[model samples]
Target: MSKWSGVLPRMAITQRSTLLLFALAWLGVCSSFTVIKDGASSLYFCKELDCPKFEEKYNSTAYQIRMYETSKWVSTTITGLDYQAATEEAFMKLFEYIEGENDQHVKIPMTVPVINRIQPGLGPVCASNFTVSFFVPFKFQSNTPKPTKKELFINTLGQEKVYVRVYHGFTNQTNFPKEAADLGDVLNSTQTYDKSYYYTAGYDSPFVSHDRHNEIWFIATDK
Candidate 1:
């Protein structure tokens, strides 16, 4: 009888300790910071001095018209898979670079609205490729740190204007195209845009609620 009592106490203590540790880890992941700069189109991950700013150079709220004067950015491309799979894989690689996995051992501030654009090739529709880009902050744009991995590279994007249709909800493979289609219809009826290419922008973390912000941007036709 005494042998059973000794074993039960240690097992119960261990179980409780494991549960406590799991809870703490979950809370820390959920509590990552999000900082929103004034008059900016997207949110920042933390209070980073060198975070990329999403300046709204033009806004026609009356017609749901918003334009972003995006600054030059360093981006890495991921190819050869479906949209969801490619994005997940590319994000990990980019995250590693920003987490001091680069030539300079630099820790770059994370930015919002991770962008993904479809790269069409001469093949079947389902076999189409996609490119994902993370905007590097302006501070590092001049002398950007090179990624340690060969798959990742840095490139600069000059200032460009994009017309966007913003929405609030989770975006997935099933719903992303539907949202893009809806935005296209509106743009066709009310305004002029470069329909040649359109891309999606996501502005929230995976842990965020269903009411998160996302956008579909059509490169605006020059005025």
Candidate 2:
């Protein structure tokens, strides 16, 4: 046997060990502090993809309180008499922006909870205002690309507390209002939140027909 044969095998083993250690370290750095196998956010139905990071401040059978960090989102408004139709139109507009219809012409990864702020009309015959928004992926939050469409723009939501009520199955015009009303009923009498406008959040796609998750968010007031 050559004198250097043993040294060669030892060197190969050392190289493998260093590579393994480096990989493990890389993973540790990539994983956020709030993420874990069974963390609060993981169990809160943000399992499939990136989502706005939040700290669960309170929980109960009726509803939960989450303090969400300030984040930016791409949003567009649609006004119509029917909630379903307006929301559909708004979704496609935002979808196009994410599908490379922006100045950068870059495709951004979709995120969870397609949230819509609904400002109910004053009268039954009036059109309601629907603002559909998609969370900007964390990587692009700092410098979001400008949308090609004039109506679409990026908006920043400041750090705020929200009362969230989780629901299952599909959300539509008929069901979301009912769900929001139910949530309002369950809230404590002393709880202060915005009643004029509420957010409907969908965490799954229409194609995902089962085990879907949705939510109604009432912005908690400082008072």
Cα lDDT tens digits, model 2, 75-159, are 9989888876676678767877877899999877666778999999999899889999988877788889999999999989989
Q: What is the C-alpha lDDT of each candidate?
A: 0.62, 0.80
Scanning candidate 1 in windows of ten residues, the lowest lDDT window is 40-49
lDDT for residue 53 in candidate 2, whole number 0-100: 83
Q: What is the C-alpha RMSD of each candidate to the true structure, in Å?
A: 9.3, 17.9
Per-prediction TM-score to the true structure, in the order listed:
0.69, 0.79
Residue pairs with colliding backbones in model 1 are: none
Highest-scoring model, lDDT: 2
**Best of the candidates, TM-score:** 2
lDDT of 2: 0.80
Steric overlap count per candidate: 0, 0
